[model samples]
Target: MANAISASPTSTDPGRIGVAVIDQDGKRPVQISAQFAVAADSSTRFQIVVSDLTDATEEVALFFCGPIRDGLDLEEVNQGPLVLSQAPNSPARYDSVLGDRSECSYTTSRLEPGHQTIVVGQSRYSFLARTGANVLYTVPGVRTVLTREDLGGETMAPLDPASTVSITMAGLPNDLQIAAAVPQLPDSGLPSWSYEVGGQPRVPGEYRVMGHLVTVENRAQATVFFAGAFVGISGAAVLWLIEILVTGALGGRPRGEPADRWEQTKERPPPRS
Candidate 1:
């Protein structure tokens, strides 16, 4: 497809147009109409805008597909069509205020320079407050050792507390590391690990590890304080798409670079009805 190229406007091929989903609410997601255009040598752009803005963490996601057809909605097609499982990777310019646990993530999939996929995703955050008296304590500043679990996209759900799982912990303080020895599973069924990152050892966020399940002992219950800013988690999407077009036309790289599929590929569930 790269062989056919020329300076004439009519000489270029209008490669497969793409679909874009825009999330204006950053909580709920909506799909925008598809767009198509011919690339100078295989360049095109599509923008999916959100019509609603009731949420503060509004974001967008983009997905690429072979072509739009009525059957496109029939099944989770994983064929040749590249399925960018997450949002774009560019730093998100949050036009709204950020609260605790509020985060914006983008995928690094770069659809063909001119040919690309566009989808929009939004983020919403909700926190759970346990029934307890609020207490604050100050301590002498001490160097804190911390351990971080990157998880690398490992799903924490559906894990058995009785079973052992391996989680990757990064950004560790030189003095501390995940005890290579098998750590004991909490009687509550949640897995816990300890390590020091920095700061006073007792400070929160000092030691962190991704556990399959962090069950409270003898409670026979699970408490998740972090609800996904599930606002509107979208698939491979583009942000400020208009800026992208302007930048490209002004003699910038025709399109953003594609990300390694190994990283973009995610543990996606089957499409829902």
Candidate 2:
């Protein structure tokens, strides 16, 4: 029975990533240890687990940058709701049930003198997950270790006192820059993707929601090639025109002027006779 249970095909192992959350409510901040993993290859899956919530209805926001890929097309997967479960032994065990999911893409273009044309691809994902009857929530991925001292205590406050969580990736690319934003709480309802956050968004209270910014870059060589070809054609045309003008002046009949004196003389003698 033990061997049969261990060999079940329904099980999967998602790689672990480090993540940490800090609650900045009191004079001393409280840190919570969290774990995350990629659910599948077709889509980027992120799972976050924070233990011990003071209020089951309290909302927590997650913000981080996804792995950067080289391409113009920003690929995104449908995100599952923020799930809550008892402090599970593994991040993969958490279930996402109550939150909403969506997809979006952002782009910027640039033209440099010598470099190739670059189109910056940015895909950012953010959502609000309310705490449920349990403590675990599945929304994203990162890897870090936390202890009792870090979490402070079993009960931690939600987004308040302007708390911040930093996720560091080892061996990050040289050209990549990570950008994060904390959305402003809406007046009537939940926040939407349309609420743009330039660079980084700032809010007075702690940001209850957090998400990721996936930055990508795509270069097109056609623009530079076309520019070079245009410059070469223009130069050749200008030189050809200048040569025609110079040759005509040396022959005593510059461009736009009448025929040369010798031709005029030959025609005039026949007229006199």
Candidate 3:
């Protein structure tokens, strides 16, 4: 069996639902429809179904993005084509007013799969509380690859090992890029490491990575945040924001140049892992 994770429903608050389908073969984007029936005691039962027209294996992720009240119970029944699993929610610290949120995912196997459609018919017993609206974001497929190779032998050693990591996002309206400190390889010849993007090596120190999604009309910006590490008695909060240009053009800067044009004070520390 494929590995799976599950989470206990955390709240009874009426919540909004968001769903996205991920096709590994990059062939199909499934259409999803949801139905809700309110029960007595101010609870609701939600039924979400996905229609998969292609043969490729699919993964469906759901996010309960809401400012609803606390406590929800999610029961999965009649799972048509998907094997249900729940992964921890990604940080949504942007919305401070909302309390804790719920996020989960389900997967379908390439073999022994359903014929045409997958159903996630689950009942969510939630409380009737008016807080705010919850919206859903869909990511068709996300690809991540990480590889490492050792460079030392029994007698002779070069230094630290080399690593290659990449993250690919598909079905996104705009292109997204990410950069960060490569994992530290043990006792390497090089004192520090240089970050690379598109095969170009960047400066040798900690950098605030930035990515811009440019379109014909507007550009969207994203900044990479680094969590701080403690060295001794006192620790410093390392935070920086890279200005995303509307044109989505990235200018080449010399090594050791500041990645951010201006500095930003540390907001809330990067959401706790």
Candidate RMSDs in order: 35.2, 21.1, 28.7
Q: Judged by lDDT, which candidate is best?
A: 3
Using TM-score as the measure, name the better of candidate 1 and candidate 3.
3
Question: Judged by TM-score, which candidate is best?
Answer: 3
lDDT of 2 by residue, 194-249 (tens): 21111122211122222221221222234446788999999988987887778756
Mind giving the per-residue lDDT tens digits that candidate 3 earns over 144-261?
1111111111111111112121221112223322212123322542212222221212211111112222331121111111222233212322221232332123444433446563
Candidate that beats the other on TM-score, 2 or 3, i.e. the better one: 3
Residue 2 in model 2: shift from native, Å?
Answer: 55
Lowest summed lDDT window (length 10), candidate 2: 97-106
* Per-model TM against the reference: 0.17, 0.25, 0.29
Task: Estimate the TM-score for candidate 2.
Answer: 0.25
RMSD of 1: 35.2
TM-score result, candidate 3: 0.29
lDDT, candidates in the order shown: 0.23, 0.27, 0.29
Comparison by lDDT, 1 against 3, better one: 3
